[model samples]
Target: MTFVITRPCCNDASCVSVCPVNCIHPTPEEPEFRTAEMLYIDPETCIDCGACVDACPVGAIFPDDELAEEDEPYLRLNADYYLDHEVDAGEPKPVRTPKLPEGEVHVAVVGAGPAAFYATEELVRHPSVHVDMFDRLPTPYGLVRAGVAPDHSATKSVERTFSSTARKKNFQYCLGVTVGEDITHDELTERYHAVVYASGASTDKRLGVDGESLPGSVAATDFVAWYNGHPDHADDAFDFSSARAVIVGNGNVALDVARILLTDPDDLASTDIAEHALDALRSSAVREVVILGRRSIADGAYTNSEFLSMRLVDGVDVVIDADDLELGDELARQVSEGSVDSTIGSKVRLAREYADHGAQGADKRFVFRYLTAPTRILGEDRVTGVRVVRNTFDADAGRIVPTEETSDIATGLVIRSIGYRGVAVDGLPFDDAAGVVPNDAGRVVGDDGVHVPGHYVAGWLKRGASGGIGTNRFCGQETASSLIADIIAGSLPAPTGSRDDVAGLLASRGVEPIDSTGWAAIDKAERDAGRASGRPRRKIVTVDGLRAAAGG
Candidate 1:
């Protein structure tokens, strides 16, 4: 019997400590763990201990008997880990908790994203710790509120957890606070025992193609932010009057953009969509969305669950080329037979349904165009079309190779959903290539091989852009452990200034950080304003609006 790790693992390695037989290889303590997407349970070890299943918070581990037909490949993947290594079926390592002193320790976390919230929650577990969290926008939950598709209400529920954490007395919520521009990192470090940089990846990875700078062309990240009422994108405009639109990547984000555009305007209006964006969408003439992928559909970036959700959306036709539906291997054949519940099977079923009933005259259609790479945007002042080249799959090289053969697709707007990259924070060491701060576990690394004591990272900044909400829990645990270790080691700095002193310093510098009460007032005003607007809860989508609503 074998056990396999699925997509939900998030590289957190909680399973590593729980496997009683030590069959789970590449624990986070191991050098290779950072590079592994998920943990693997060696099938040949024959211990069959279910300790890992109990440890995984997200339920990523599965026994051989429980493995769905689609997950059978993971059985082989897990077995392969032991092909060249000595098997270790020894006793599991014990779980360790942080040790802290008796006094309260003040900490400042920059960014109101999931990482920051989780880190603060973990820190507060040490009864003697207090957290002051700051964000540039008045609202919190960086990506949950801004980047996630508004239609994904289930994922949006993460905000509830964050809200609950913010209610803690030791945790302070400071909105409308920008670190470098409003307050310096040096000042934060000076005022708190430790400072954590959880500011998530803010910028989109641009598609460096000609005409990408056109007015109608936009990054999917920015578009998501605009529709989701992110303050930064409040004034941004999206043109959907064109019959057709083109998306450059085939990630879950691309699927999100496509679904939002293709969804019924009436359905969207009832949700928490921004009033302005919803109004624009109601009048949108968009009929077709072409999702361009450099590789075959088999290697698309979106997960099975996301694709399934896209297919389940009402009043939208998911179109795909019939030729592309040909199963190339045994796994694909199994997927086609419905013997598997894998991601590809979900997408294949949707594609087959759409192809059977052609979407030529449908109200809205999302078409998946495989083996196509965007060469350039075609337009003068606004996006009018896209030039695409044929691509050949290089199985050996594990990448899609673009060919010279080209085609043109008419489109009114272009959205690139390539990926996200982290940015350098002031007074922190950042890796330009990896788009991460150099860190060992949670300890921020600096030149001369010295660790920046009391500074830490979690979530995407520490592990890159991957995993879901639950992923942050373990990431936060690791960072918190490191923090407690530092405190126990007497390496953490003592808070030099009082709360009033920090506030006075900020006021002197013309920067005002919103207190918890102010955030509550802003929250109330938004809910009231949303009630008036006849939506679930309309957000004050601008910094000025939030400030005004908060009576700042």
Candidate 2:
């Protein structure tokens, strides 16, 4: 049977490289690859060799007949892509490792996230290359361990690839070492042939509306971190005393927040969700989540996969108002006629179906409201409500504008999931307005517009916060290529000190960096604890706890 690409597909393109017949659409070489929600396999061209099933890092591919009841829709979804777009079954391209500088090329990568792992994966392919990866946290896998919703365990499986990379003899972990605080950027450049920064966007975008800084209103980033057991937010106390929570954006993250609020706490108990967050969820008074969008349903930012998943939650009713889909006569007609991209058409269609189904008196409600923008958050002490204004899509300017009508939504909590903003790396020149390090093709550029030698960046920090977990593969590869090219040209400076010297410096500073063995001990401790509780793993959610688990 032909394989179906299902939800949680990270678009890492590993499957694309292994497909013997090149059945996957939107290969990394294609323009649509950047925007594709998930890669689709062309059923007509399939040899059904199961190469993609093995290559898929996230385990998103499965035989059509083997799909779970909830994922059966993907069988049709994969075929639908080929209906609209033609497939070129060209000779499949194999994954290749680029040749690097012959001698030992030492590199230091900051941040232990997907980008950092992917960059390290590329760098360690050479026999003589050694990488020292650093992270501020005691544990690794920054967002994969901390940002992804707990329910998405398949997405977390990409950690297996990262684990393999970490096992390479040429790679070493320097966990719990904060670059700026423990070691300066200048020191990193002085100690390694090249320094790659893969630290992801750490902060969230704000509503900038009045009362946004109030206690009840919080960034979705912090909430995700809190729930996912990021040590930084493990002790966070969320006021779920309110029956209704309003999320002020309609991206996948906003949906994730809504799902977490509405999902049965028992359903999450087996997952890696933090114990404190789980207890809070079990006692949460939240019953309804209202997700607001500034534009029409056709222009919503969330992907079709996420939208579909919302409907399948066990006890939650997905609500959509018919009025929200009534864009002007012309625009509505375009959506109905499937004149827009297939993904957008599917979202509008799904929304209309939900509107027709109406609310089913479920225990929890997920409400979607379009053409609305928050003018201000309401309350004196904490968020009691939000003052929102009606909006209309101005076709000419291609933007949404506020209308005269206004309404107040009474909600005790407000979550802004607008987007993530990259925090400035300690010594890197940053564009404060854009929330990204100023770089040209992964090379860090200074305010004077000159490339800073031996310094590079990848992932969200390099190109704002966009794309999913797998997108970092291409990003990391690009940055690694730039570093390798510089090394070949002798543009990078020679290292003044050895790895032993850096270790001595850390020891002098009273910083005991966790190596791969130490992290493995922490991993085993967490898994052992999780086994007793029948969970994936009970995450060690504090620096001291993690260190103790690692036998530090």
Candidate 3:
């Protein structure tokens, strides 16, 4: 019987490492693993030992007979790889390591996000290797804890894996450490054999329109951070007094923000959402959230899981234009006709259900507005409304083209969730147009055409903004492989001194980094604080609070 890998696989490849016969085609070490949309097991070579089934963290694996009718497609998807390729079962294969190493190496990874955590995990595999992980925030996991919507707790489970990796003695987490401001690139390079920058894109891409700078206008990134209790955004205020709000994007983040505003405050109170934001949301008067997409519904950017979660949220109305719901192209037709279960199909089903309920002028409405471009923000001081231009779908070009016909939508608050842009790290060569460090695979590329030796990047900083949390595992593996190759090639530079020397240098420069024990204290404090409130864990949302929790 065939075993299928479903969408929930998350690309973490936890199953790949556990297959005794190396039956998993794209092991994390394989070159194809980097680009494969998802992992596939070679059915022909399978011993059906069910080792992979037991190893999967997200329950993405299923036997053929047990496969749900909707997931039956994956059975063939798993078998297709073996049909085109030959598998030598008699040949001896090297055992795979969930952890592997190249040699004696010292590495410093910036940021404690998923990317950094994965890099550290890979780096610590070496018997003689050590890693120093840095983050500006006192706590780590970047967006996993801060940017992810509270309702998506399953997504945040990645943190437990990250926590497990952080426990490695070789992996040192340096929290509350600002790279450019506190410690310079030169200093880090002087202390480690190589430095991997996993610091994710921190800024939001702006919409260059009038009234976007109004008082009530805010970037969805900051709003997300505020509600998630990100220390940087703990005190930031989001005005939800307006009965109607406009969200200018069609991505998962837009859906996340909309659901957060509309979800029952009582439901959120039990989650890890910041107490301050919870209090604000409890009193929120927001009744309608208009999610605007410049392109047609077909081009909207939320995944199936995210869209389904939004639809399943209680006490919210989702509206979609019936005319605009027509399938656009061959892929869209396939999805609409039920040949595939794409995210758009889920959205269409959800939209139809909401449409069937009929529009009630009073209850909260999540209007999914398609083919609209915000032309101007209409307000004197604070946001009162927005001017929008009608957009026509350019099917040939596969984009939205704005038209002269314009109209106004009454909105008290405006949230731009357009996109995320990476900021330049000091002393690193950044491609302003791409909003990333110019890198070849994983090596940092300089403007003068020389490769920056031992400097690397992964995740959103290496690849453009894309993929889910598990995507970073492969991204980080690639970066780590490149780093290991450089070390094996004797191209990586050696650290000038020991960890003590590095810490002394930073302290001399008036910069103090919280160590592992310190981070543990902070973690305990957050958990204890959450326990006090009957929630999962309330984060320490400020530098001072984090420092104090860390026993400073």
Candidate 4:
């Protein structure tokens, strides 16, 4: 049997280059690669070299026979992709590492997340290129550490790859240093040949409804950051006293919040979730979480992998009303005929399955309400309920239109998980509508559409908040390529200042940037603490605590 690409697939295409028989589909060269949730292996390709198993950074590949019970579905899912598309199974192409110019090049990257690390990985490949990565947080791996669900350890395993890049001789990290405050953009440009901003979307998109600012109404990003122990939201509090929680969007983030709220505290206790968040979850009275979507199920933003994962949660019932899905006879016919997109077909099938299989009367329940939009959050001081209006998916118009039907969902909390928006950098040109830095293929663009000299962007900051962890690899590489192209063209000039000069300037500013050694200390301390508790590393949720763990 062929190996299966499981849910943790980062879609970085690392396995594609290493596959001996080219079994993995949606290669970087394929158009489907851009939208594919995860790469799949063709079951018909039988050499079974197992090379991808070692090449995958996230440990997503497993032999069909070796697959865990929870992941058994992926075996069939991998083969299903081949049913629709023909498998080429061509010879693997040789991997190529780009050669760099001879002159020494130093680039400063703002943000120590996956994007920055991936970009650094590209640049540091050349012995002549040096990278200095900066982040305001004392820690690195921005969203990987602060946004990913703590229970998704396989996804978090990608930190190992980032750590490898950190160990590169030419790379350096300047943590806990604010760019606009401690050092200006001009200062960074003066100190390096180029500066690449990878600081991702830090803020959430608002619902723009009345009573949204109420105490119990919060953004899903805040909840994610809070549970993941982000220092900025470490002290944030949530009232889980209400039995029902209403989520304004039906995205993966909403599912994550619902699962965490309804999950057995014992299951989460072993994760790296924040101590305070864990304590709050343990005492939570929330038993039912209603996820509202303004559009039909076919237009759902969440991947089928995440939607199906809800079924695996023990002691939790996934409730989906068949009528709410709005799956007309035509859509069902398309799904049955295999004419619809495979991703959408799987999602619709899974949703119908959930709807058909009535709830087993589990203690906790996650309900999906589609074609519903929240008009207002109802409460005097805090969230009491959400006034939502039912919408009809005007398939002919390809838009959702409001109907006369309106109802109130009784709940203590309302979480808007609509989406994330990037914050504008103080010195960079920002696209207010897109919530991204205006850029053309990773090169920063000004208001006049001219490229900003020695300035570049990667990740969500460049393209808006889209794609997943592995998507950043190519995104960062594109920015790095732009920087390289600038370097080759002699457009990027050598720095006037040196690293020592920058260090002295930071010292003068009283900004004690945490070095790699200090971060290692903090990591080790957390792991050691977690080992004592028989859990993964207990996260240091506060900035002061992280700094203290890093030996100040």
Please list the C-alpha lDDT of all candidates, in the order they appear: 0.76, 0.89, 0.79, 0.88
Please list the Cα RMSD from the true structure of every candidate, rounded to 1 decimal place: 6.1, 1.4, 4.4, 1.4
Question: What is the alpha-carbon lDDT of model 2 when measured against the actual structure?
Answer: 0.89
lDDT per residue for candidate 3 within 98-119, as digits (tens), equals: 4434455778899898888887
Cα RMSD for predicted model 1: 6.1
How would you encode candidate 4's per-residue C-alpha lDDT over 247-292 as one tens digit per residue?
Answer: 8887778888888888888999989998999999989999999999
In lDDT terms, which candidate is top?
Answer: 2
- Cα displacement (angstroms), candidate 1, residue 206, comes to 1.6
Each model's TM-score?
0.81, 0.97, 0.86, 0.97
lDDT of 4 at 1: 66
Residue-level lDDT for 494 in candidate 3:
70
Which pairs, if any, clash in model 2? none
Model 3 clashing-pair count: 0
Off by over 4 Å in 2: 328-330
Model 3 weakest 10-residue run by lDDT? 84-93
Model 4 whole-model lDDT (C-alpha atoms)? 0.88
- RMSD of candidate 4 to true structure, Å: 1.4
Listed per model in order, the count of residue pairs whose N, CA or C atoms clash below 3 Å is 0, 0, 0, 0
Give the number of colliding residue pairs in candidate 4.
0
